[model samples]
Target: MPRAVLRARGALRRALPALLVYAGVRALGIAVLAVWGYWTGKSPHQLLSARWDSLWYARIAEDGYGYTLHLPGGKVHSDLAFFPLLPWLERGLSAVFPLSAGDAGLVVSAVSSLLAAWAVYLIGERLYGRRAGVALVALWAALPVGIVQSMAYSESLFTALAAWSLYAVLTGRWVWAGSFAALAGLTRPVGAAVVLAVWLGVLVALRQGKEHGERGEEAARPALPRMLLGAVLAPLGWLAYFAWVGVRTGGPTGYLDVQGGWGNGFDGGLAFGSFVAQRLFGPAFAAGLGLLVGVGLVLWLYAACVRQRQPLPLLGYAGAVLLLALTAKGYFGSKPRLMMPAFPLLLPLAVAAARARPVRAVLTVSTVVLVSAVYGAFWLNGSGPP
Candidate 1:
């Protein structure tokens, strides 16, 4: 075998433990989901790949967008609100293989989840150490909403792109970072976070350059072109689609209007706050408490990230993602899944887990894994993954 091939195999071997942990948690979630599905007389795979937004994506893949659902209440749900990259890949994969678009989506998500774990591990390792990286992957996999990572959804793909893009920024690979950011923009609205992260990192670098005078200029000069190119390229994919939506809907604000039709738009968290308030005062007070705790946990972890002095790119991405997820109108139940791509929030936990005794770490992760699996199964057996 060639040396490069051998080396690649060796690297995979080293990374296998983290990959296996991710796969194990995901498998447990799927197994639980399958059991729930059987009890409910439903298909688990269908639930994963053919329901809610998954169906929307696959429909777009097969039919090439321009579809809309008009309700009796005069609400319009346009396929244009969904991003294009996942469906584009699904369409291409389905055409090249024997799989249906839905199946292709599952395949893409499954592959992307693994790649996401790997990229996440690499970032953790780069910043902290190998053990922290491994722990990070496992913790990410064991998230209550981690099941979405394995579903035929865009989260895994977008996360893979975002993670690698951030990694590229951290490693000074400007063009690759921008390219991945652009692809991420094509994947989800949160792609803007990745784009912002790239530019933020560049700005920080430039500021540091000023602090170093001629020495900094000498170091940053050669890479300046690439950094600028990356910043310019980062938003084009999403911008193109946004412009296309504007043209198709015959108004400059068509995309925003379409989102508004579905009760999705930036409301500065007013709707979300109202929902929480109602629930807190209503019969579901306990449920309201749970929601509040979840949000609190997210906020606390982000604070931890900030205290840990995580890289500017990570902070930028995490902050943007949190802001967007929190501020989005309606779809309150989807907040957890929406926040799943903000993996930087988990770094502090991963660091703590890495320092724990092996037995303790295993027990902690195992307990959470079990809870997550059951939660995922229950979530899917009912109204799932909006």
Candidate 2:
């Protein structure tokens, strides 16, 4: 076989353990959901593949967009607020198989989740080691919102693209990084995080080249064109979609206006802070405290990532994702799902786990898996969107 094929086989062999762990953890979650749905007289399939954004994506796939819903209180929701990539994939998948668009979406999400886990592992391994990579995958798989990974939603697809883009940057494959970043941009608004990673990686490279001597600069000159090309490509998909939305709506700020109609905007966290504050004074005080703790933990993780001196790409991506998740004004319940793409925040914990005794690491991950499975089951059975 060729060298590339040999290298790929070797990489898969190394990633197998992490993949297996992720699969097991997710399987446990699905099992819990299945039992809970059965006992609660709900269909697990419906829960995973036909609710909330999944319903919107399936409708978009089947109907080809141009949907508008007038909510009470003068809120105008448009299907265009949902990104196109997931719907496109669902449409294609359904056409190729004997499945409805909704079912096809679940398939798409399942495959994408595994791919995302693989990319997450590769990035951690590239930065630290195999153990750290495995730890990172387990930590990510056991996240409180990990159930969303298996849902027929865009999170898995977006995360796969984003993680691969970050991996491409880490491996110095600028063109690949840009390509994945663009695909990510097409998946969700948070895809901007991956674009930021690619841009930051390029800028950092260019700066390092500047700092080098004349000989080193000459050595770096050949890669400069590709780096520049990658940076240019990073935002094209996002810009293209936004431009298309603008044209379709017949206004320059059409996309922004559409999102605004859904009560989504960047308010620098003021809206989110107020939302939390409101809960704290009511019977929901405990829930408010829990929310505060969650936010604090995420912020602390980012701080730990920074203290560990992560690469600029990881730092920039994490920072951008953090900013967008906390600052965006929308359904507060969606914050955890929005923050799911910021996998780099788990690095500090992953590194610690990798350094710990094997038994301790396994036990901790096992406990987290149990918690996530039970919480996911309970959360899904409730009348709320994940």
Candidate 3:
């Protein structure tokens, strides 16, 4: 072979393990969903395209946000139930392409998932090294809830926005970070976490500079003000949508009533925790036990964070993600999937793995693949959560 061709081959060979790991995990997850759909006498396309959560998004896309579903209990207001960003994008993209609102949502989600993986690579490489970047990306793609990444869901899109926004914050691109945070806030209610983390980082940097009595350009930085502005911009889109819904419904409480219709009213975690405890000690106790184990796993991750002295930005991001996951109502079975965006929590372990032998790395990745494959398959079959 030519020298250039040989060098390119070598580079690809070096990257092949990580790529294969990612592909294998995601492929298994997709295969599981496909096989289950077939066995259940359901079309894979419909399974993939069916309006699950996508239905509400499509409604928002086609109808431009309105309240409906007046029941004996009350009016179930959807406008306040979902954020406007994803549906708006779906509408815009469908306008240009001859795709249904659902198809458009899936296309957007797939693209966002790929971009999120790339962003993970960039952030991991910057924080640790190339191997850590590769491992982290693979780990993220192989998550047991991997099916969500391929569905017409907002998880992938939100992760992409959050990851890139954090990257921008770390690189001192304050305006870009703020812009992305605003978009993320519009996409999901959790966008506040990224905005808060960035602002806190800026505040810490400023305080350190002042304490040192430095007279340099770095010391007189105007980062805090920009960070605060970024934080403020994050929630505007969600608030605007709620306000519109309130005006149209002729009551500010209309949105909350809609969420209550789906048993997702924000009454706090007490009721939710009781429901989970019942599940844990009841007939489906094994699954509840597994969830408790997952909580323990999160605590272990927190301990690792302290041991490794990981940055406050990462810590805050992970904490916010955990809080959101735990505080949510309904679909208690999907908590693991909901927490998938917090993949940065594994960066410390990924960095450590980068220093191990190639053989050990392969073994570690194989174990993850084997377990995730089984778990992912069960999840797709609707045997896991509601």
lDDT leader? 2
lDDT of 1 at 335: 90
Q: Which portions of model 2 miss their true places by more than 4 Å?
A: none
**Candidate 3: which pairs clash?**
77-258
| TM-score of each model, in listed order | 0.96, 0.98, 0.85
Error of 1 at 49 (Å): 1.2
Q: Residue 187 error for model 2, in Å? A: 0.4
Each model's number of backbone clashes?
0, 0, 1
Cα lDDT tens digits for candidate 3, 242-295: 676678668887656556766664455666678769879899898778767877
Which is the winner by TM-score between candidate 1 and candidate 2? 2
- How far does residue 251 in candidate 1 sit from its true spot (Å)? 1.8
> Cα lDDT for residue 12, model 1?
69
Q: What is the lDDT of candidate 3?
A: 0.73
Q: How well is each residue in 255-285 modelled by candidate 2, as lDDT tens digits?
A: 9999999999999999999999988998899
- lDDT for position 304 in model 3: 86
Indicate the residue-level lDDT of 10 in model 1.
74
Q: Model 1 Cα RMSD, Å?
A: 1.8
